[model samples]
Target: MSQRYHVVDRPDSRAPLDPRKLAQVLAQDGQLLLPMLDLIEHAEAAVDDLIDVMGRATIEAVLLMSAAGVAGPKQQGKRADRDVVYHGSQAGRVALKERQLRVTKPRLRKRAPQSGEPGEVEVPAYEAMRKDGRLADRMLEILIAGVSTRRYEHVLPEMAETVGVSKSEVSREAIEAGERLLKGLAERDLSGPDILAVWIDGIQLGPYHVICAVGVDADSHKHVLGLREGATENSAVATALLEDLVRRGLDPERRRLFIIDGAKALRAAIDRVFGADQPVQRCRNHKLRNVTGHLPKDQHEQAKATLRAAFKLDAKEGMAKLEQYASWLEHQWPDAAGSLREGLEEMFTINRLGLPSLLRRCLGTTNLIDNGHSAARDRMRRVRNWQSGSMALRWTAAAFDAASKGFRRIIGYEHIWMLKAALEEPAKDRSLVQQAVAG
Candidate 1:
């Protein structure tokens, strides 16, 4: 074996308990015996306590080594040059998820700083945990995951008891965290994202409805644009969201596509804010749902197939076929026919623009934003009652932030060029074409 390095079977340290002694004690007659569950619990507690003890010992060992100038043993001549001296130990506490250790924290005094050296001596471990905010962040993550504050005592027994975790404190922290997220969402600069399209939809929480906009950039990345609380998808609410986007750097002159559920107010808002000629695609899926919802169960599949097939054809033919279907259903199901006829032309905007099938499939509906809403609902599923719009907005902002983390590029991203070309067509050229068609 080399003198420089050696390995021992076990380090010279005192074991907390001897396994053989424990077994002998357990086997003794007329002794109070622990049930298996209690024994296992006690064993786990012992292990945790031992781990804390080991950590404290390691910290003390490092302090000692620093004081000696070398990691372990100092050479005879080199020991005299040591600059760090261990002062004394003071009571201190550090938190870990499993436990908080009451440590005899070692103090160190260092020689005066030489040129270019730091003057202060600091505890590396203590400073590290404090700087990282891991302890606070871990607690916040637990609460955000819908863990009850009372149960935190069980989850983080030592830290919770030591710091006195309270329900009010947890609620305050969560609200503060949520407000920070909401502020970031509202104030974040949208100029950099290169948004190519925006999808808007409403989600209901309790009796409140929040309209959310999710934007897709040229690179196919999605961003949670913003949100507004509204009772219905009305012009005022829709205009506010669009104007907010414009204020935050969305270019109304850029001719980006608006993928939305077919609401007259939303369409009117787009025409007023963006332009009358702006490219808009009403969600085909929403239209399908509305039409089929009004039809008899026996007629649903047939209507759905007819509508879906018609949507695949060229704009004029598709509209003609749908009109024929509506006429056929006019007598037995006038309401269903009317639902199908409403916004019928807007549903085939993608086809009219002659976008590629792949890109059409991605942008033809507001499903992308709807998917994000689904994720937001999953995050907020634990929330029972909403107190106000502000409260709902804060929670929704936090939920959106969480949901947006997993956004991948839109499907059929490669064919995005086809849609881009359609959008880039000149307004003057489109106007003249429409005029000629009308003539």
Candidate 2:
């Protein structure tokens, strides 16, 4: 037996001894992992708190000592006890962090996480969680939450105790803290997404560009990449947006469907960025309005019904119903039937396969993004009209970040898979279609 390394059969300093002689520890204690992360986190928060306290305390001490008779040269010469206390506290913090760093040992991490040999290696599970890139996400949530959400109450009226930067020094500190988090998210190497679809479109925020990327995540739930400010909804920005999505951990190969409303810039951008073959679908409900606009008031309801039939979760039956409705419209309402005859059918382009909940929700007209947009608009509506484009965009983005905190992205995995595939091309699957009975 080597004296340098033992099986830990005898209890060690990390875990208690003499409790169970038969079982050696399977891994280093995971409980320590959280504490380790917290240790560094608290060290930082402590530094911030100290700065605030020292600033206020030093100001108070100076005023008090001056009132008591210390003035001019004497006041300058008399060093307040507050300075000594502040330095002492800071020194303690330095000592505390040094102790924590000893145990964190982030540098000890393996060069190769997997050796490819199948034997099990003892690893602390909690450490493994952050080791596999989850640390970035966890840290992102923490940092973004701080500046981007509740913490920003200092910047505006609605939310927090810290209202208005109140002072220039506080403003600088808050801004610096926010930039640190945003810079990390913006610069990190985002890879390995296995993306199944990409939702690209320039959303309206008063008059500014609010291009966004929405799509399914690893667990197959939809995630909103973010709202880009000032970036044109044109081909250049959309292309850059695609590349950004890739950096934000989206994989292009896994994504096949591109859903958007028919904005000329958005369409051109997607094509210029993603190329012509990228499977695209116009929002179904949005198209129906155009379709019905051509109809007589009396026929609008009938036309809507006909259009809705095509969106049935069943492909074959919907197609047959669509044909019957088209025939009725073309023959009976010739004056209003031309647009439907020419392009309304294309709206059904992705619905012919079994509807994926994502496609189904998207195809029917109102995209889930539309809902978020609506929420933003409701807030902006209070302003009557925004004073400037930046004002509108900022309010909208902040509103979304605040409101979407509770928005649970529906992945509709099974639906998204079929919807993505069906969007690829469905003429081949046309023959596999049978009349689907309504549930």
Candidate 3:
């Protein structure tokens, strides 16, 4: 067999080449074609070794450029008038992407203008590379993506001399990042978003209960409003969460619909904070589950169908059908009947508002907020222990912050205007009623 090689012509060595243009071309192409003989000779080299070689070369180039800016050229003759002088090189660690890289950093010293004291001059490149603020962000992202702290080091790219990958350091970075996220979420301004509805729900993390509020704006965009830690989803916890949201810029007087799981405390808190006149919608799913949970398994489908069908009717007709269903259950399952009757009117709030079917479906339940809670739970699944309420809050905030990035407009967002109109009608009616009474 005869082996044939493809020959390529080399560029003229006499031609003046721009280093920056060559770099730009290489960066854009991301590869260089080598001679066949050289390629064959280096075929056995591992990719990891090549990457290390390239990284070191790039770092050296950057340091040289940075050094030139401060200490001038290396081979230049010494001058007494020089303001800065090379102070030799030192081994230093710089943050490189998700990990740290050890490099030889060139040092320079500056002489004081009046006093002859020497001051250390910072290498711009080294200082820029040494900033590890993004390292904390990367750690939080990895941890939130389900990488455990113990396994954090293993997940990172292998480096020759990396630091801050130990389990303790990883934990500290995640804690600091989580605290920042918690603070950011807590302090976010809610007044800017023209929120048309708010959903409140509680999730239990170990022994702690956290009440979370998510708002749906006029454009059907959801915002994580606030969270409060409590022993349970009690009136105080819900009240505190709502108050925090209001304090952060959620308008208390805004005619927005309040959606909540069938919790009396949550309903009470809404009435207390946002006023009793603010429309409240009980989660139909929670209501169905609560009502059916009291009955035999065989009766679940029938009861659920009845409740669901009733939700589609007009407010009066829906309430009447629910009342009839409650009466039927009262004979055999008074608990089920009571559950059905609980917050009965609020279940029909969306229907009473005369919203379009699409808006009604979107606003009728607490699923908007529940979906965010699901994302938060998935992000926090690796957390084995909840050390304290603050820890739980921190993790929850970080998880939700990560989750919010993937959120899109709610389903039936096109009909969001209908909801806005529906929410405003009651406020308009109340104003008119008050005026008539005053007259």
Candidate 4:
């Protein structure tokens, strides 16, 4: 049929416009739109896989050299010169990495039977190039950022007159690689950490929310631990995340403490999984704000001083000071004070254990856990339009994982007794818990 093409014919559109060129550009742009992340997943897999493949390939190459003498030549009885060496072969690796399959021609020297003259033996090139391996290490670093920082399309460069990588290739390569690798961390089995502590917090990235758990070993070394997403940092959500950790082999019960913001659900989940048997320390800073809320604004400054005094005072002074604070709160705002004072009561109970400094440091609102979240938030703040909760978790897992790396154990061994004793107790004796901590 005679047709009228619904096409725009502007000066830039026509003269001799090409549809393929347009479609190619459009398709490429479309690929860039794909939610491809960095090559983080395949990077890990590739590192392992390449090590395996290259490793086996090198072995096979050496075997070939052996066979050149054992099965085919007299020199086969001698040691193969290649020896599957790990170093001094940049050319071999460069070619192998670039090609996904490399072909290495091993040179063999032997005495010629015909003339007793030295003749070099030619061995077929053992292929060692991995076509997808180029720029992977370099691209890997970028890919990790693309996924963690969610900088997907901007990952590539060399695109224009001004300068930048073409968006399409960047998407096709870096992000696809990263996205694949990022997925790996989700499915891979994580070994159980000593888990001296589990620090939990939620991070906001654009529209998504990610709850992060950082685990610390007995030695105080930390791991990213786990990540989850939800409407709020509730116990159910924290429990679900902990469940996932269980599925992945993390033993929460074995963890010494679950360091988290003083959220009910988190506490509930800890009690559910670890039981009230484990020591639950309120983050000290949160406790201060919480207890101070019971008093009037005019009294807050004075009440804080009183509460601090109680926290640091000897047993009897601490008791009287707490009662004084509570009595004042009951007079000003009974309900608020009642609710706020309940937690302060827990703090007092923990402190009576004689693990005074440890109690103040651990059972109180934990700046370590909060500090971890703050750093994570700062890093992911720049990412706009986070795609989903899982997407946010990816960024969180990497960020929190990276942030927890420097955690140092500030609590001393002498203090471990109160915490350890509290953990061993059968009943919920806040008094005994306090005694152990105070001791």
Q: Which candidate has the highest lDDT of all?
A: 3
Report the lDDT tens digits of candidate 1 across residue range 1-439. 6577675665635555543333333333212322321332233223233235333443333333333332223344443344654444465565544234554444655655588886446555443322333344445556555565666666654421244456676667667777777888888789997787889888888888888999888788899999888733678998998899899988888888889888788888999889987778889999989998988899989998998899888888888999999999999999999999998878887887777777889889989988877876776676777788887787778777777777899988887776677778787887776555335
> Per-residue lDDT of 1-439 in model 3, one digit per residue for the tens?
9999997766776686553444334333432422311332333322223336555444545555566656766655666456877777788876644566666767788855457654888876566556536778778899988889877777877554555467887789889998999888888988799999888888889888888888889988888888789732588877888888889998888888888887777778888988988888889999988988999999999998998899889888888999998998999999999999988988988877677777788789988888878888888898889999998898888888888888899888998888887667766685674455335
- Candidate 2, residues 1-439: lDDT per residue as tens digits? 6577555554556773431121112112223223333442333223222224332222222222222221111234455543111111010001110011111111112223456643222222223222232222322233233343334334332311122322343334434443443454355454644455556555565556677555654446655565555444365666676667665665554426666765556667666555665656677666677667777788778777767756763545665676667677787666455655554434554664456546466544436677777665664453444456545445555555555676774545445556555545554454345233222
Q: Rank the candidates by lDDT, best first.
A: 3, 1, 4, 2
User: Model 4 misses residue 59 by how many Å?
Assistant: 25
Q: Could you tell me every candidate's TM-score relative to the true structure? A: 0.73, 0.52, 0.81, 0.57
Error of 4 at 190 (Å): 6.4
* Model 3 global lDDT (CA atoms, 0 to 1): 0.76
Q: Distance (Å) between predicted and true CA of 324, model 4?
A: 2.2
Q: Where does the lowest 10-residue lDDT sum fall in candidate 2?
A: 89-98
**Candidate lDDT (C-alpha), each:** 0.70, 0.46, 0.76, 0.53
Candidate 1, pairs of clashing residues: none
TM-score, candidate number 3? 0.81
Candidate 1 TM-score to native: 0.73
How would the candidate models be sorted by TM-score, starting from the highest? Answer: 3, 1, 4, 2
